[model samples]
Target chain A: MSNAAFVIIAIFTLAAALAAATLRKLMHAALSFAVALVGLAALFFLLGAEFVGLALVFIYIGAVAVLIVFTILLTRRDVGKDRGFNWAGVLIALAVFCGLTWSILKTQSLSIVAPHIRALTVKRIGEALMTGYVWPLQCVGLLLTAALIGALILVMEEKR
Target chain B: MTPTLQAFVLVSGALFSIGLLAALSRRHAIFILIGIELMLAAANLNFIAFWHFAPQPHQPTGVMFAIFSIAISAAEAAIGLAMVIAVYRHYHTTNVDQLDQLKG
Candidate 1:
């Protein structure tokens, strides 16, 4: 049952990601990227990490996608006219994919099925964050603050 | 029966390569940023998949890592896009190849 679901979501995600990667139009590519991210979040849900899935949707789709779109809007002087499609990149990506797929297939120890999934509740995640991951959490908070300030400063107007 | 870990890994690998394709093939700076986001997402997927398939009675470290990775990616996207916009403002063009001020 879940196998079919995984196959479906995987295909959807890969197709959208392909579109996002190769699409000539910036807006279309960004929208396709958002779709791909949602599909990935669904895959996360299938993996029984509902909290993480929700967070993915929230952060990626909600925040990042909007940011990309706005940036596209703000910098609209050259849209749908990007030239120079580098073929070397495609070749390199294909080579990397082939190598990774081959290695994944050859790994004998990874043939085991997923163990019984314990429902990792948001409460448990919160507890884990508060108890064990407190230091890292604080660091992330500081990092986010720095990023926010940095972004603001980067886009701020220059003094004459 | 649940799907094997190999399947999930394979999917994420494909995603990662596609991201590489985006980052490499596109001429626009924003597209490169998009590609980077895709790559980071692929890594996050791998982390969650490994956490899901690990042995019983394990810590939820994988999930935590994924969550943190997501946060960091968000920050990266904001900063990267802001830089892109700033560059666009200064240069009036966002095409990476045309920016040759530092190119020797």
Candidate 2:
């Protein structure tokens, strides 16, 4: 059943997220973050947003995770350094979870099941991106270009 | 059978809180960025869930939003990690706890 699959993926994601939050080793934590993203993509697939799911896997796991690992490798004086964490932050995260869960449970409107709708294919997404969302897509492209140049400028060696 | 909308929301909430924990608690700058990425993904999950559960799920608004969001987040991660590397070049340390000086 899909419910069982959802449960499994949810548990896997949560567990990997927790590991990423708590792991002492930086590389391990980054890898765990990738795993968590994969599980999230699985949840997206289960929700029937297949294109987004694939994008999630491709971007987060393929691009973002590798980028993080490379950044870690590049900016390193100590690879085996101890990653100290603040217990107060953990307490705050728990408090946030409690508040969110309480509000979600108290709201009766969120109990509805998913509607039977036509599949959201990649073609439809492409069509919308070309038609109604074209401007935003172009803006995003420009933003990405600006980000690339800005990042390069930021990390450029200062001429002494 | 498919789970209810609340179920998906709850999972998203849990992932978000975990991300908050990572972003707030971690000592390394890259770890903080990773946490922020997780938080963004959690929001994307919520958007997709709502789009799926809508009364009339005709528009592909949520999927479009998620795609754009992912794009923006990628840019953000690139810029943030670049900042991390630049700061490391100057300070020679990746731990945020030690980078206390305001003006380098």
Candidate 2 chain A, run of 10 with poorest lDDT: A76-85
- Give the Cα error of residue A71 in candidate 2, in Å: 0.7
Candidate 1's DockQ = 0.84
Q: After superposition, how far is residue A16 of candidate 1 from its true place, in Å?
A: 0.4
> Cα miss at A123, model 1 (Å)?
1.0
Give one digit per residue, the lDDT tens place, for model 1 in A9-63: 9999999999999988899999999999999999998888889999999999999
Per-model C-alpha lDDT, please?
0.93, 0.91
Clash-forming residue pairs, model 2: none
- Which sections of candidate 1 miss by over 4 Å? none
Question: What lDDT score goes with residue B76 in model 1?
Answer: 99
Q: Against the true structure, whose TM-score is highest?
A: 1
Tell me how much of the true interface, by contacts, candidate 2 captures: 0.87
